[model samples]
Target: MEMFGKTLCVTFDDLVGSGVMSKANYKRYVREEKFSFMQRGGNGRKVLIIYDKLPDKIRTEIDTKNPGAKDKIKKQQINPMDHRLKSDSKAVEFYKKYTPKISLDRQTEYVLNVKVLNAMVALEVSMRDAQGKCGFQNNKEIREKVIALCENLRERYRHTLPKARLMEKYAAYKKYGYAVLVNGNSGNQSARKVGPMEGRLLLKLKRSKFPVYTDMQIFEEFNRIVEERNARATREEDKLKPIASPQTVINYLYKTSIKLWWYGVVHGEIAFKNEFMPQFDTKLPDMPNTLWYGDGTKLNLYYKEYDKKQKRMVARTIDVYEVMDACTEVFLGYSFGAENFLTQYDAYRMALETWKVKPYEIVTDNQGGHKKPEAQYFFKRICHLHKTTIRTTASPKPSKALSDASRCR
Candidate 1:
């Protein structure tokens, strides 16, 4: 029964709470009419009812019940200048270092411009006796009032100097004066090669992507496109695009947004799902020996052995079976040998002997040796004796479940 923002949406729960509709009727109504709604919140479970898109009857009903909806929405609306501002403790310590005596010869024009605008803002704030008071209420009012008064300052710098950004720059100005505004890469020739336009092209190319293009391949393609444009250009400005290094492409590719773009492409869909998709969080046993996890992998350590046919020493690794207590993640038993039913039995036996108590449940992967007749009989006998149930689950990620021994290997 409340309006929020420009969208004029309400929660389904709110509608039900206000007695405008029943949960069952809402579900059935949406289904029969094929109504469209927005989904949001964690796992997109929270449904939003858009008021404008609703049928006339429902919209009228909502309007009748929610009389103060417009007023409420206006009050709730976020002001552009309403921001929480705080002072850095280090600013006081840095105040003396940023005196008028500091040299400006090495500072870039852009830095000078930013500092000048910020200094004007600082002067206005001081004139109003608003110094040292960095609370959101005080600063928000100061910024809102001062921005209106500083017409020339706004015109010289960015016209749309956002209040939040202004507050940030103001803090920087207090800390390091003009020096903090100086662009670190302003004078570096090599760093300027992949400029903003080229960076945008790199991102665009990544979005319109190939499945198997490596970083180096993409880097070469990026330079090729730039070079091609440069070759066909008639004017000097059009031919000014510089050739960037592979490292620059690499750095751009690893940026947060770029990594998300290539997540499924580089690592496969399964890896993407494992990393980003919502998963069920299973409850663990409360005590030790209640549940156990068993898995096996080849040990990375190798021994040199003479191959009779090749008549040369070749390095080979042996399989290692391991059992871990589910609650504590402690390795209870392990056996190293060729992977088979015997090796698995040895590990399980070691665990049973050492722990002196049988686990109620044992989870393991569907390994070939586990299905062997001998292995089945042995497991069945143990289960019958200890009242244990063996369950098969997907193997865990190697990085998560690997042991100290695995790390050493």
Candidate 2:
């Protein structure tokens, strides 16, 4: 019973050496637990800590015998650290990049992840520099000594070498590399809505010869298709499945995380190409305040105003009139108010107030309000006073009557 209690926690070698398991079964156990095993350094110095989970049967027995043995085993009880793992190449690389995962364990659970990683590195560095030129590979005694020293330090600074981290940090580091540390799952994500099959289905339906469907309706069709696939699935392992939420389909297929892709999906390929695909290689402005443009923009938010008839405040979005220096693309002045408040009168007022020396020329869109007899006369009088040229943008596809109306008005 004393012997059993003493050996309650066993390393891979301890179990195999004691005739409890064969080499083959122990390996299966290691893989099943996804143990983090670092290779012993090529030199006699530098031993890496190997953290493995206890087999469930062993764990249960320990807990049954000692009650709170689970918590004690996790802390200062001191498990095996540096027994070499097949000197596994892949496992070595995996250990280097993905030792500790991050999560709310750091926040809510208060897991000491940083201390563990730090202690691991510290033990390796101290072990990396041995005083004697004693051992390399063939000598088992010195290697065990180095590993023993590491486990001692781990026990001494138990907090620094926590057995388990709180969070999974579950990201595909193989595909995304180190970005998984910061970007998590969002990094290096595929542009396609999801994997190739769902993507192909989406593209097939969207770009088909038949009439196109709306995003919601198309996702419903996708759900039905997945259901059919699920129903006809011969084996559970062979099931070709899509995720449950329709929102995922929308996110993968139509979300504006990538605006250009969304535009291409909504508007035709040509429209997207014409609008955003063009490379904008351009030069700097020749000079500042050489010319100016004036326009009014409708602000997005609404303002509440007391209504005379209804005797209650009503919400209405306002417009903003602004003058800009065309050369520098600098906003010169702006004024915003109720919907009808920012008009040609406000535009002219802002332009005159903003300029220290009047711009050589001023331009505006050909809005009928800007072209009103009163407005044209007001601007014409203002330009004469300021000695500046005022011009309106040309109607690119002018109608005959519209052209005649413009000249007469």
Best-fitting candidate, scored by lDDT: 1
Pairs that collide, model 1: none
TM-scores, all candidates, are 0.31, 0.25
When summed lDDT is taken over every stretch of 10 residues in candidate 2, the lowest stretch is: 1-10
lDDT of each: 0.60, 0.48
With candidate 2 superimposed using the best TM-score fit, by how many Å does residue 268's alpha carbon deviate from the native? 2.3
Residue-wise C-alpha lDDT for candidate 2, range 215-307, written one tens digit per residue = 667667776776787787777754544544344465566544434334555575666666665455635447875566676788787878999
What C-alpha RMSD separates each model from the true structure? Answer: 21.7, 24.3
Residue 292, candidate 1: alpha-carbon lDDT? 79
lDDT of 1 by residue, 88-133 (tens): 3343333223322223443333343454455556555563553343
Give RMSD (Å) of candidate 1 vs. truth. 21.7
Q: For residue 371, what is the lDDT in candidate 1?
A: 70
Clashing residue pairs for model 2: 46-127, 46-128, 193-252
Model 1 ranges off by over 4 Å:
1-267, 274-276, 280-284, 300-302, 371-409
